[model samples]
Target: MLNAVIIGCGGRGQIFAEYAKQYPNEMRVFAIAEKRDYLREKMKKEYDIDDKYIFSDYHDLFEKGKIGDVIFIATQDNQHIEPALMALSAGYKNLMVEKPIDRDLKKCILLSKKAKEYGAKLQICHSLRFAPFYRKMKELIDTGVIGEVKHINQTEGVGYFHQAHSYVRGDWANEDKSSPMILAKCCHDMDLLVYLTGSHTARVSSYGLGGFFSEKNAPEGSSARCIDCKISDKCPYNAVRIYEERPNTTGRGAVEKEGFSNLEDAMRKGRYGRCVFRCDNDVVDHQVSNIMFENGATANLTMTAFTKDCNRVTRVMGTYGEIVGSFNDFEIYVKPFLGNDKKYEVEKIESGHGGADTVVVADFLASARGEKEMCTPIDISIESHAMCEAAEISRRTGKSIEIADIMSDKEGALL
Candidate 1:
């Protein structure tokens, strides 16, 4: 059986590990490195790992020599590069790294190059590539059902509560610490656009701002913490209402999964209980990017935190027809200029990230075993990251940034 070691035992890492249980014969977790004692112990118990195989520091695991056939790096965005470089240097030949390999463009390029130099097989967790929804879309486009793509429009509706939880008060709230909203949240869209169009992005222009989740926008009577706010009952972002209430009104289970016994306890101990507006958050809540591809196709992408539902809505227009879809419904509608229209519904699966988590794990294991090539290898994944980096530059400078300019800078850095 293929063996794997997880470098971060957080929620995403755990999700990846669950696949091993689902396909016990294909692969299994042999070890884990987690900073949190509880989480590390949880993995150790679940995987039946020995104490010697559990590490609080990933560096320690790498130092002890190779422990598995593959390494899964699910650390935070900024924390990805060092472990990845170290893992490759330590003779690990297969790596599954979470996306945006690094927030900095230079670091991303360097890590990608280093993996190649080390002859490592690298897969970035652009998991959507393996999801059924996107896979069907790719099939339709590849068969020319939509004809030659002319323009595409896509939107990522970050539900209001989710925006507050992830972008306002969570680990990814700050651009300096993690990445810009475009990279942190919408790189998947950029990647999909590139993948579907099968063309390199030529130029990108974007506009965005951190509009609502800030101290200036805080309700007049709101307190620094939701637990102390006078309007906690009425405020939509009340941490207690979102976390403490059983089957919470917001319909999200992040706090429950966090194992917080009560709202008061969570407020006293966790960052999730902090007031969204009062937190040290700086990422934008809304952004729009316009892209021009080398093949003359154009695209527009909008990401916003004010939506009532969390879904990706996409409309792809081609020379002879168009395809429109929504992830929430797992459905697609296609209308041709000269033929009969069609509808498709993707069969739903339970794994997180739209059933991509498990499929990607399966693919990674297959790739490691020399059975098949990875769907989202580092070379293909890096293009999307470059598009995101250009979009962020355009957002800040108020000018369209050329992809060639970004690539040239990387070349100059290498020189």
Candidate 2:
């Protein structure tokens, strides 16, 4: 059996631990490292991990604990770099790190080089790449059912209320803490597009802003708390009301940390935990990107935080046919238009993205054991990461950015 360790006992860390437990016969969670005292204690009790195996700092886990065969890094967006490097340098042979690698392109490049030089196997957590629905779509496309793809469209409906709670007024509201919305949230989408199209995005154009999630846009005299706000009944972005009606729903807060000392304090302050419109949420709530594939095809992407519902919609168009689908529990639909008539195929999955998390972890484990190839490699992730950064630049500068111009070398491309 391979010994394993998980850093960060927050939500993502917990999920990784659960997966590790599922494969107890193959791997075991031998240690845990977390910064928050409550979370550390919670992990101990929740996972039954011994106190001796817990450390306040992740580096301390690597320094003092027995070296695990593989390390799982699921920390916050801006906090993955040091622990990853430390683990590799400490002689861990395998690593499965969460997506985007790092916010800083230069640092990611340097770490990639170090991993290659040190002979430490690396697997990035682009979970959607392993989603069964997407995998089937890739297979169909490869078999020419989608033909030579000519155009693609991807839409991510980041509900307005959830964006306010988790992004605008929450932990990742600030770019300094997480990253631009493109990098932090939409890297998965960009990477998915690149992976399916099998082409590098030659160029991109973007436009977005902090339109609706700001104090100036809020109704006058409205309290920040949706439960207390006078407009709670009519306002579209009411959280308390929404959650009360849909208890089992997953919000962005579910995926991210809120960073507020208390929910009541946020409501009173009206910035971090308060009313959606009244908070100091400056992150972009809506954005669009147009990408030109190397094969001269184009893909359009839309991200919005002001939707009545939440989900992702995708369509791939080719010379002979087209494949269209949705990821948010909607039925997957494929239409093949071959001049005679249109044929439709619909498949319903058991989980969101059709068990993406399972596939991602299983594939990584197989790759670590040298039993299979990576569905998403460092080089592919680098392309998606750069695309996200460049799209942000385009949105800020109001200009088109060329991928070739930004990354002219293989080293740069891997970043």
**Candidate number achieving the greatest TM-score relative to the actual structure:** 1
Extract clashing residue pairs from model 2.
224-275
Over 4 Å off in model 2, which ranges? Answer: 245-272, 339-353, 409-415
Q: Candidate 1 — which residues are off by over 4 angstroms?
A: 244-263
lDDT (10s digit) by residue, model 2, range 1-415: 6667888877677777766667777667778898888778767876687788889999788877346677889898868878888888888778888876898877777777788888877777887788776777787789886579998889988776567666776666778767888888789889988988888889999999875666777887677576578877777667665444443333323322444344444344434336776655567888999899888889988988877666778888988878777766434555667554343344443434457776677777787788998777665687888888889999999999988776665355564
How high is the lDDT of residue 14 in model 2?
A: 75
Candidate 1, residues 72-110, lDDT tens digits: the string is 999888899999999999999999999878877788888
Displacement of the residue 246 alpha carbon in candidate 2, Å: 5.3
Single out the weakest 10-residue window by summed lDDT for candidate 2.
247-256
RMSD of 1: 2.2
